[model samples]
Target: MLLSDFIREGRKALLALYPAPEAGNLMTRLFSARLGLPPHTPLVHPETEIPPASLDLLQDDLDRLLHGEPLQYVLGAATFCGRDFKVSPAVLIPRPETELLVERALAAIDGAGPGCRVLDLCTGSGCIAWTLMLERPGLCVTAVDLSGEALAEARSQFPDRPAPHFVRADVLTQPRIDGGPFHLIVSNPPYVLERQKAQMRRNVLDYEPEMALFVPDGNPLLFYRAIAGMALTQLLPGGTGIVEINDALGPDTADIFIQAGFSDVSLLPDLSGRDRFIQFQRPF
Candidate 1:
């Protein structure tokens, strides 16, 4: 089948789930990944034919997308900080907003000296952990996650030896890191309240791991509380902590750090002006 024909049909099928522009974009990315052609290739080379073997693969992936699987999971990878990281049903796909957390953390780290210790709580897909480590080469990062499948995927994000150290630990339980004082702590932990699920789409609820996404409706800030409490002793004096937070609970989430006695507790907004991150520093 011609690439143009496949994209036309794929976008039509996806239109029922996503908007026209988004559906078109998804089809473009799908074609790019599956065929190694640029998104605009089909527009230019409308008659380009796809071989029978490739068509079978595309059909399988298209069916999965139609059934509510996220494109990242279907593609088996996600790009974060310009690096493509492996992803699966085992982990949550990295979102563009989470990049804000990384940016803030990196900015905070600029003043800190080399060889600083970093801890990443609820490190699904290791996107934040690996980004920090790669962006700041000398920082030692220890990342923890409760899901073994997620830990496995996180470990696979980069080179084994030079990569962030991945650990299996429940963030709710205050898992101990042998290294006492981390210079920075970062996370993009579960913040979605069960009640908020209604506002979300079926693709996220069905494809992503529930444990990595949702919290009890009664306590939407559960992970934030846990990470803040853990930071009390684990963060080095003058160390910084940053986390991705639900826009709806920005002030409440900042209160966790404030009440915990961290200095400079503040809520940062994303591009849309939603309160998306909480940043604080351990007292000097």
Candidate 2:
């Protein structure tokens, strides 16, 4: 079958779940990433035939997409902080907004002493951890996650780079993780309230790891409170901690760190201008 015909049908099939533009983009990404064809392949070579083997693979991926599996999980990777990181059902797919946490983290660590340390809590796919270690050389990073499967997925990313020491531990349990006194502590931990799940798409609800994406609605700040408690002892004096937060609880999330004895607690916004992150510092 011709690539153009495949793209037309794929976009139509995906329209049930995604808008036309997004569906088209997904199709473009699928062809480019999976088949190594250019994004404009359908436009430039409309008659290009998809081989039987490649067509079968595309059909399998399409089936998964139609069934509410995220494209990232189907593709087995997600891009975060300008790097593609391995992802699976065991981990949450990285989001673009989480890049803001990494940006702020890099800023906080600027001009730090050699071998600066970072702690990443609930490090699902290790996107933030790997991005920091790669974007800034000579840094020591330790990442923690509860699920062995999630830890395995995080550990498998970027083997050639200086690896963060991935630990299997619950973020809610404050005393377990060591190798801290870190210059920076960052997390994109589970902040989505259970009630908010209704507002989300089926692809995320069904495919992403539930442990990595949600908290009980009655205790919406569960992970933030735990993160704040852990940061109190783990972060060094004057060190920074940042996290991606649910937009609906921006001020409340910031107050968690402030009430935990952290200083300079700040609620920040994402590109959409919704409060999406909180940053705080350990007093010197």
Clash pairs (backbone) in predicted model 2: none
- Model 2 lDDT per residue over 173-280, tens place: 656477878889999888888888989888888778888888898998988888888888889999999999989998888888988999999899999899998889
Q: Candidate 1 — which pairs collide?
A: none
By summed lDDT, which 10 consecutive residues of candidate 2 come out lowest?
Answer: 171-180
TM-score of 1: 0.97
Please identify model 1 stretches exceeding 4 Å from their true place.
none
Best by lDDT: 1
Q: What TM-score would every model get versus the actual structure?
A: 0.97, 0.97
Question: What's the alpha carbon RMSD for model 1?
Answer: 1.3
Model 1's lDDT to the true fold?
Answer: 0.89
Model 1 / residue 119 / CA error / Å? 0.4
Model 2 whole-model lDDT (C-alpha atoms) = 0.88
The number of clashing residue pairs in model 2 is 0
Residue lDDT tens for model 1, 37-56: 97789878888998888999
Cα error of candidate 1 at position 125, Å: 0.3
